[model samples]
Target: EQVKVSKQNFLLGRGERLTDDIVIKGGGGPKEPPYTFGEARRRLSPMVSETSSRIDELPQAACPGDEAVISLTINPEYVAKSFFPHELMRDVGIEVIGSRPKKTVPEKRSRGREPSEVFTTELFARGRRAAIRNWSQQLPDWRSDRGSANALISIEEISAPVPHAKIKGSLPEQGRMALETVLHASELEFSMIQAFAAYLESQGIEADLGHSFFAKGLCFLELDAPVERADDIALFTGVRTLRQMPSLRILRPTVRSADIPTTDLELPTEGPVSEDVRVAIFDGGVPENHALTQWTSRLELPGMLPATEGFLSHGVGVTSAALFGHIDTKVPLPRPYANIDHYRVLDEAPGQDPHKLYEILGRIEGVLSSQEYDFINLSLGPCLPIEDDDVHAWTAVLDDRLSRVSTLAMIAVGNGGEGDSILGLDRVQVPSDCVNALAIGACDTPGKDWQRAPYSSKGPGRSPGLVKPDLVDFGGEFSRPFVVVAPDATPSLTTTGGTSFAAPSVLRLGTGIRAHFGSNLNHLAIRTLLVHTCEEGDQDHKENHKEIGWGRVARSLDDIILCDDDTVRVVYQGEISPAKYIRAAIPVPADPMSGMVTIKATICYKTQTDPHHPGNYTQAGLEVTFRPNDSKYSRNNQVHPNSASFFGSSLPGATEDELRRDAWKWENCLHAVQRKRGSSLINPCFDIHYNARLEGRNFAPPESLSYAMVVSIHAKGVADLYDQVVRQYATQIEPLRPVLEMPIRT
Candidate 1:
């Protein structure tokens, strides 16, 4: 077999250190010798110039025939020659052939068909370490056949294909002895002395002191290097460290949504009844006088530095916009409602602490359990490595623990620009990384680049593949303050951009949808609506976009005012299973007994699958809704259901006050269910299940359901029958009931 020489196989240098080498044009392996030097000279004469009289100094063996292996390396200039073909000397007796990749190389040369590139580089937060002890040892014949001399190739540089800095030096006698001592004592492999010697040289320092070998890439129990050079070492060869990238320019606010200022649309000015719903803002604290609230209070983080400081005003700004942006001010914006119960977690002193955060999460749990909050928005995160199980596991624990109790725990994906924190196995931040947690990434409209904000973190997920951010919203500066605060306070609003800002806007929008629609609004359903009804763009083009996980979200404040309906429409496909349930909820206004009301519901859906792989299946559906007559009961049943209870529920009559008391029980139960708990009270029982058979197994296709319930009330005897008709038409629904039941099995 002819050894094929290819340009791609040729590498400039191995590892981090720069070095050079030359190659032998053609040669056969050991065990064969040419008849005489003169005979070899004659065979090589045509390939050499007359000045190359010393060519015969090296001997060549004859080809061993077509069945035998032949080894050779092409001249470096062979690249210049573009794989120039050459005729072999027939007398050599070897069958010269094109070279194949190592994987495709004949089995005999492989000794035992071992895999190539079977090496791992241990990545740290900053750098990576690779061990060459298990690397294949190059045989003497291998070098001679390749036309390389007797120098041993350093495995550190050439072992793996990745590029990095390398250090090389001779270890001190004492250092080498100490290294040997430590290695022997610790039952380690490789020459620790040599490794340390090289490391010192790479760091531009001298190590006269001895060191010991430790396991897992830690070669030193102690070192002789100077301590002052620590910064330099960390900057260069130390663990993976990173510098913040250059900051981006703040872009101007530009709205492109069809819902923005489209054909003067007037909403029911006095239609919405203040529910006094409390929602927590898990970001920077709220600012006093913020347009959302004329009245505000502060919460303290136990270990915070400044005692009274909040993370920042960013979170408060978001909440203010969401719950009460509709306040009257000299600089009047869209201040809709003033009802809000806010919790500030991020901007507290000494920065946000996860431990403290667990407490905050507990607080959210309490609020949710007490039925005091309509939702909670988390606009903050941590700057830690999250690509491993420990971090992800921790985040999972939080999500599992918190999500069950909170009405909505919205987390931000962080404003860490693309590729910023990707170093050292670092993944997206925690909380957002947690499963069941809704992570939100930011989007800028008429976005300067007409693209998603450059800073928004993206994900399919780093570790367990959590469906992060659930949805996106216009989180840019333009929607800030307005989307962030409730509609009662007055505060200075400024430019704020982040998934943090977007999160609140979506949260508020969700609340509004739920308020006018109903509390049964399933977030997944809203996410689907955003994906389907939001402004659409080139789908094929977004395949590579990381930030715009789905695409630009489409929101319609206008549509919400005009639309009058609610529902869960399931279009079944394939065999449905009983294992997975399709759960949905919508907001329902209080039912009014004094007047007539109207309610309309519908469900629309379709079966979909990958065009290329139809065997893989999924389902999608939609439901339009309308309610003209919603009864406002004096005693509203606002009971909070456990996570599982919410997933699949059976109802009983209870006033809103009673419901608040059960909220925590509901959340705790839900959390337990997520943890796979079993018990009659907490176990998931009622649900519309679907099975999406995957591979040879059937499973549930992803399911989503949304709900909205609206109710209008009127005083009795205040109007004529015809006038009463108009009033009743405005709000007419009494304890609305529209349900869907489906069974799917895997």
Candidate 2:
């Protein structure tokens, strides 16, 4: 058979071998291996020299000291190159501040042409004038290295900052506009707030600085101005100034309360509180006199004011749901098993000042770092929707804290899913987009009829596309909302619906899992178990995925961990090192009548991150593969016989680069496959391979990265499959049994 290979394939480092039984109908012919491989290699050898000469001959320009930021378009071949591209920047005194995948538009199909792929990264360098000038002169050499070694495609100066539409749109007609701006930490010495204020004054625009945030090398500044002068202020502080400062990143509108429908509700008084699980709820202050008050230990954190009547309902309802499963009086339930600690972070008023809300980041950090709690439930978030290109300060802070702690936090995905706004679909609000936190969305009801609530947030998440609403829970439908305690002192019940209620329901489930597994179980293991047991309904449909995530979580911990006859579940909890592989073998039944075998697995891990680099946020990623131990299922015969690697390449004809570009680098990943029983395997054993990689800078490849893997095998019409496997490989396989803890009898 004749094989045709393109020059681009040679450039991408994929043309080294020609596999069996394939006909490539183009340039190369079979029986000419030396000629085919030799010709391509010869053509690729002179690329560097040619590129270097061309770069040196091109025009040169001196870069200003203030405008030291440059964006590099890396060649797609950079990953396969011998040298890391970032090292080139370092040699020239350039600092690779942050990087994100460059967005590409698919080209229209044309005859005899393949789509092109380009990788772009941004670099920032700061030094004295002489150093800046010297580095600028080395541009040609940098370009030469990039072109020859396939490290970079092009280098260009980043001259301006982009204006945020939300900031401009939120400006008032006459009064001053309130703006929240995040400046790069490197530029803080410039005193950006003062510079901007002075600039505004020169334009006869009065400006007030309200708050400043300093964390993770970020400087958040709050500015207020009259509505009429807002546009002028925006113009003066726009892209041109960003070019000069190189550190100011984004300017957004401060969030304010929007009218949401609310009705008062009475607290549930039927359940007794057990001290088995400890959870902290951060929101408005909880009233000490509520019906569930005896079950909770209330503490108002310093800097938080007392809760008022208007702000009491939200906190009361969320706390009630977290402590007691559901607020409906008709649903009979046992005494609550989880203890509660309520921390008031929000003010008692109906609405919060945006500046004050921004200040809450520090308070949250303090509580998360110092407080002792097994689980944290956050029913609050900003009104602003998360941006694909930017990681909000709130989300970054929360993710950083969660990664460092053993405890897991659950955040509401927000109730902004209603209306015609694009944010209503596939745009989970900030903090909820925190990749480390389990962001919960609202389901319309409980049990089999559960659907995504109209007011529940949806998400493909921000860039890198971490699927949001990791799990959904009953938050109540429009017509059948969850009942809650009213704001008034009297005992009364009101119906309401939002993701705020849904988060606690999931937290309640986490508490149960914690109770069974004990506090020793890592958060990743618990997260894996919860996602492993999620019930998928209409999830195969692509649209429903963004709306419901992995689908609604199981109601009980036993339902999640325990397996019935004919099904075997295995759980692996361990850590993986960079560039190393962890393998697990599963013993399969050898019976011809083993029936259909279905395999489902969930992998969850926590990763360190460069919060400033929204484009390349997560620092570590897990690549997983599941396949039969049989050697016959080689790469040539099967599309993805090697299992679903980090890029999910098990599907037919998917290329490595294609999968790598689409893989989710977030902390949580899930994949499942089902196959009918057949006699193709010589060995009835299956293997799982886990590989870990350190994807960004400043991340010390941990000696071992902790992770959890849950695998379940089910057979149809084969009642003895579980017994057969357990008996055959008793030492290698073990059933996942819930640790039963007896309830205290009252």
lDDT of each: 0.33, 0.56
Tens digits of per-residue lDDT, candidate 2, 407-445, equal 778988877676446534336777888777788998887
| Poorest stretch of ten by lDDT in candidate 2 | 9-18
lDDT of 2: 0.56
Candidate 1 TM-score over all chains jointly: 0.40
Model 1, CA-based lDDT: 0.33
Clashes of each: 129, 20
- Candidate 1 residues 450-526, lDDT tens each? 45566566654432222344455666644422233322242233344566567666666656544543433444333
